[model samples]
Every structure is written in structure tokens, then in C-alpha cells.
Target: MRVALFTTCLADTLYPNTLRATVRLLERLGCEVAFPEEQTCCGQMHYNTGYREHARSLARRHNEVFHGYQAVIAPSGSCVGMVSELYPGLAGTPAPTYELTEFLVDVLEVTDVGAYFPHRVTYHPTCHSLRMLGVGTRPHQLLAAVRGLDLIPLPESESCCGFGGTFALKNADTSTAMLADKMRQVLGTGAEVVSAGDNSCLMHIGGGLSRLHSGVRPVHLAEILASTEEDPWLPETR
Candidate 1:
């Protein structure tokens, strides 16, 4: 199947490896992935911030850029939620959008994409993926199939990491408190890494982990799924 990659702004800017891993994993699964350079932000920031007109403009551009693809896939559930859930109201028709795990499990019909990551990893279901996209068990299914990966259950895994785009900045105190709770849960798991579908949430959680000088690392689901024994994903320095 041929698909267009909607590399969300956060992944493109801060976590290019996640995008690269997404492409690699898809190509390994016999997919022809294309990156439409004309693709831009999904205007989620604008829309969530109450700039509906600006969001609509970008939504139209998003549809225009990726109109012809059989499927539109993104690594971040946050942006996918924006496209699939809000785009209909913002733009005329919402693009056929699916979060990476959703496309892999539902559309592609494969869980084990021949990945290996020998580490204790816990998954955090971001608000958008859980509440908005309802991407439950899709991520878990894929992770369970991964060779050498010890998937530990995160305590209160569905709780928000307090990074609701602008929510972190606007409600800094509340965000930090929530993040502190999240960090405590992550540390309790004794997992070496915390994984999630959205980098924005990972960034927020990672910041707390780093400040605490905790050895735990935040990793994207795409990166974990993309890893193979021959070409393994090296852990980032804390």
C-alpha cells in the first residue's frame, strides 16, 4: 500500500529519528511511503488555542497536500486526533488519518514487524491516543510481539502527562504536578525506558525524568517498533 507520511511538527523538529523509524518500519512491511513536502502542520496548536480560522486554513492545506494517498499515517496520535476528530468541523472533509499503531494493527493487519529491543519498557497512553483516537491495545499488541522486549505495565498508564500542547504553558503548576505524578509512576515500574505514541508527551515526561537525574529514557513507539537486531536503535544518553 502507498501512503503519505504526515510528520507532525514536534516529530519533524525535535525527533526526526521517530519519523525515519516510521518510514523504515512501513517500508519493511511492504509499504511505499511518500513524504509530501507540501505537507505542513495540522494546525492543532491554533485550533486548540481558539484560532479556528487559522486552523481551518492549515486543515485545507493539509487535505490539499495529502489528498491522493491511500492512507495518511502519522507517528503522533495528538496530530492524528486533530485531523480525524476535529478536521471535519474545521475543514469540509477530514482526511483519512490514522495513528501509526492504528494503521499497523487495523489497516496493515500485522503486529510483529520483526523488531527487537531487549529492555524493560513501559508505555504511556497519551490523552489524544486514549481519549481522542481510542487507540487502545493496538500499541500493546505490537509491543508484545517484539522480540526481547519486556513490556511492563505502567501504573495509571492512561493518566495525562500534563502536556496538552499549550496546556503545559498556560497551567504550568497543574501541569508540573501531573507530570510529577506521572514520573513517580514511571519510576515505580523499574523500567529503563518509557514509551508513548506522541513525542510531545514524551518530551514533557522526559523533561521531568531528566531534571530528577533519573536514568529512565523516553522513547517513541515508532523507534521501538522499527528496531531490528541487525540495525538496532541505540539508547540515547540521559
Candidate 2:
């Protein structure tokens, strides 16, 4: 099947390798993936920020660029949720977008991943995964199936990482406060690596840990699942 890669704005700007790993992993699995140059922002910012008219134009742009693909896959659960859930609420149409993990598990339907990573790992279920998409254990269902993973449980796994895009700006104080609790949980776990479906949240939480010189690292869900013991890049902070 032909897949279009929606790297999402944050991933393109900060976590470029995450998408690279995603593309590489897909190719390894014998799937064709394309990056649509005409694709830009998914218009989630404008809509979330209350600029409905502009958001509509941007959404129209996204659909126009992505319409031909048999399937569209994005690296961020937040972006996927915005496109799948919010886009319909706003535009009254179907886009058939999938979060990377959701796509891997739901559409691809293979758990072994033909990949491996020998690391102590923990997953932070992003808000879109928990509430918007109600993905439940579908992500976990995939992660646990990796060949050599030592998955650890995150305390209060449902809590937010405090990076709700503009929410971080509109309520910086509250955002940091919430993030503090998440960091506390991550450290409390003693896991070597933390992973999530959303890079924006990872950036917010990972930035805090970096400032404190914490050894724990943050990674995207795709990068973790993409790792094969033979070709491991295990999402360490770079």
C-alpha cells in the first residue's frame, strides 16, 4: 500500500530523525511511503487557537495535498487526533488519518515489528491517545510485542505531560505545574528511556529533564518500535 508521511510541524522542526526512522522502518517492512512537499501545517494551530476561517483553509490545503494516498500516517498522536477527530468536527469530512502506532497496529496489523531494542522503556500515553482517540492499550499492545523490550510501568500513566501546544503558552504556569508532576512520575520509575506518541509532549518533558541533567531520555513511539536489535538507535537524547 502507498502511504503518505505527515511528519507534523513539531517533528519536522525538532524531531526530523523520528520521521526518517519511520520511513526507514516502513520500507524495511516492504511498504511504500512518500513525503508530500506541498504538505505544510495541518491547520490544527489555527483551529485550536480560535481562527476557524484560516484553519479551514489550512485544512482544505491538507486534504488537497493528501487526498490521493491510499493511507496517511503521521508521527504524532496529537496531529493524528486533530486530523481524525477535530478535522471531522470542523469540516464534516473523512480524512482516514492514523497515528503512527495506531497505523502500525490497526492498519498494518502486525505486532512483531521485525525490530528489536534492548532497553528499559516506559510509555507516556499522550492526551490524544487517552482521551480524544481513546486508543486504550492498542499502543501498549504493539510495544509489548517488541522482541527484546523491558517495558516499565509509568505511574499515573494517564496524566498529561503539560504540552497542549498553545495550552503551554496560554497557561504557562499551569502547564509547568502539570509537567512537574509528570517529570516526578518519570523519575520515580527509574526507567532509562521514556517514549510517547507525541513529540511536543516529549519535548516539553524532555526539555525539563535535560535542564536538570537527568540521564533519562525521551523518544517517539515510532523510533522505539522501528529499532531492530541489528539496527538499534534506541531514542537516546542527542
Leading candidate by lDDT: 1
Per-residue alpha-carbon lDDT of model 2 for 92-172, expressed as tens digits?
664578877777778888766776777888999999878988778877887898877889999998988888999999999
lDDT of 2: 0.84
Give lDDT tens digits, candidate 1, residues 1-238: 9999999998888899999999999999999999999988999999988899999999999989988789999998999999998888878775578999999999999998999999999999999999999999999999999999999999998889998989999999999999999999999999999999999999999999999999999999999999999999986543
Pairs with backbone N, CA or C atoms under 3 Å apart (clashes), candidate 1 = none
TM-score of 1: 0.98
Superposition TM-score, candidate 2 onto the true structure: 0.95
Q: Estimate each model's TM-score.
A: 0.98, 0.95
Worst ten in a row by lDDT for model 2 = 86-95
C-alpha root-mean-square deviation, candidate 1: 1.1
